[model samples]
Target: MIPALRQDRGQAFPIYVVMVAGLLFLAFAFFAVGQASATRNGAQGAADSAALAAAQRAREELGLRFPGVLTAPGGLDDIFKDEGFVAAARDEAVSFGAKNHADLLPGGWQPHPGRTGQFEFTVTVQTQYTVGRSVIPGTEQDHAKASATAVIELRCGLPPGSGGDNAPAPPPVTITCDGQDVPVDPLPKLEKIFTVKLVD
Candidate 1:
């Protein structure tokens, strides 16, 4: 009877080992699922933040000069280049776990001038995901995209229609160093002229 009992115990050891292995597998699967969920949440937060930053930058650029302010005399392209809007958007998106390629993020914009006393700035950022192992070997990794639009207040030292009411205005002040009316240029350090404000 003692020898038979020992044989039974030895056979049961294999079954116990298999059961433990199965339990370990299940725990690992649960951990993976939790990790994937956390990753997605974090990635989504990053996307929203990046989009907002880009849009804000675009809005600031649009409002600068803007035909009313004499601080910076130029067009929208100057502000776009000076503010580095695209680069900022790409940097923000890349900072949030987008590391598939060095140039992983691509950003673009479309200007929609507001007709109702506001300015619109639309920014779009696209990047490839970098979550580990979630993208299976045979399938392509997920793509992340974010977009945002910002409204800017166009105000200067004067209010709207300050020059006149439904009438043509006179010529603006022009600086002259020699014979001709030399255009006044803003300082190079003057990059962003729009101030950020929070309204209730």
Candidate 2:
């Protein structure tokens, strides 16, 4: 009886070792998956932030070019046509991406095409980063990237024109944003019309 018990114990030890090894492998796999997901989310956040920064900078540039109250006659051609506009946007995007621990890919900064005179300036940014160390075999280094877009609009309305002597003076056109009424002739405040959102 004693000899038989010893043999059974030896068999049980090998089975237990195999089970523990399998569980360890599964745990490592789950850890790798979680790390990859975290890296991807970080990359996406960096892209979104970078895109917003680019769009905000562009909006400020437009505001500077069109300071004060803007009438209907003026066009955005000059602002868009400036050679430095695109460069400035790209620089801002890269700067923001670096701040978020990501690097902007080559030619990752692009202005939306076929959008002219709409005051809808859109900028897309792609960013990539490496995960913390290499846990998974052949996956020690992974590239995670994402893109985002932002838009800026001009909000205004034409006041009714006075008719004749009997007609009362037209009320001043007002611009309100985020619940605050903007001054009728204040300096260009794109914050009132600018909106940043993640599109991808």
Candidate 3:
């Protein structure tokens, strides 16, 4: 009876070990799925940030900083017409994919004007990320999709010299003594009055 009990105990231990291993494998799979989802969300957030930054930069280059300026009202419209906001958004989508590690998806842009000269451009970026194929065996293919929309508005306060009438001041003139003759700066005033006779 004692010998039989020992043999049964050895068999039971192996079975218990196998069950524990299986449970651990399942737990690891669950963790992997959660991690993949988090990573996908992070990529989407990055895409949103990038799109907004690009739009802001484009608007800034177009001189859309001030609201009350005569050009500010139509500044975004001008940008959309001249620069093509939709195209810029598409470029941004590609950039986001490279920078954020996601597959680029469909997106678009729309121009909307706010109170006063404030202009806003709505930009949307969409992307998908593939995550988790292990543990589920046949369910290896899964995609997480995300979409981000941003409203980029022109900043208030006109930049320096934006509407100001102050032209660049005239350059200063310098006179130097060159031993043989006094050298005057090349200015219209000096050029008009001074004439040189060359002996050589």
CA RMSD, predictions in order: 9.4, 5.9, 16.4
Candidate 1, superposed: residue stretches over 4 Å from native: 66-129, 134-165, 168-200
lDDT of 1 by residue, 125-191 (tens): 4544434553234223543444545444332232233343334344344432223443334412222
lDDT of 3 by residue, 1-200 (tens): 99999999999999999999999998978877786777578666765665565554444444432222223334223333444444555556467655766655453444454334233444444435456566656434665555554444432222333333333222222222222222223322322222111110
Q: Which lDDT values do the candidates have, in the order given? A: 0.44, 0.60, 0.47
Question: Per-residue alpha-carbon lDDT of model 2 for 70-144, expressed as tens digits?
Answer: 332322233345545556777888888888878876666667533443333243333355654544776666677
Better of 1 and 2 by TM-score: 2
Question: Which pairs clash inside model 1?
Answer: none
In angstroms, how far off is 1's CA in candidate 1? 3.4
Residue 6 C-alpha lDDT in model 3: 98
The per-candidate count of clashes, in order, stands at 0, 0, 1
Q: For every model shown, what is its TM-score relative to the native structure? A: 0.46, 0.73, 0.53
- Pull out the clashing pairs in model 3: 133-140
